[model samples]
Target: MNRNKDKAWYIADVGDDLIYIAEKLNTKANSEDYHFENELLMLKEVLETLESLECLKEHSE
Candidate 1:
């Protein structure tokens, strides 16, 4: 999901930022930090989805 092509892809910016942070914190061991990291990834997905929906709604108006 490369999104650099279009300025409408605001959600993509958030997704890419999360991916960057996720790459840096991968400790490869089970711990609270790992769980927290996973949660962040999940939240990123949810946020991107919500943003995409909002964009669609605005366009349909």
Candidate 2:
């Protein structure tokens, strides 16, 4: 098995997980809950980074 492909798949999986968490947070968050907003933002940033990594991995193949 190609390690790079495996790594890319893992990254994509994590990104999907982050997206799910973000969706849940959005549904459960209220206007007063700044913490939830912050968490969602952080998740978005991490997901973006993971997407970039996946793109690079594909290009390197």
Which candidate achieves the best lDDT against the true structure?
A: 2
**RMSD (Å) per prediction:** 6.0, 3.7
- List model 2 lDDT by residue over 1-61, tens digit each: 5867877676778778787876777766654554666666777777787777778768977
What is candidate 2's CA lDDT for residue 18?
A: 80
Candidate with maximal TM-score: 2
Please write out the lDDT profile of model 1 over residues 1-61, one tens digit for every residue: 2333454465666677667656656653444454565657766776777777678668866
Instruction: Give the TM-scores of the predictions, in the order they appear.
Output: 0.44, 0.47
Indicate the worst ten consecutive residues by lDDT in candidate 1.
1-10
Show where candidate 2 strays beyond 4 Å.
30-61
Cα lDDT computed for each candidate against the true fold: 0.62, 0.73
Clashes (backbone N, CA, C under 3 Å), per candidate, total 0, 0
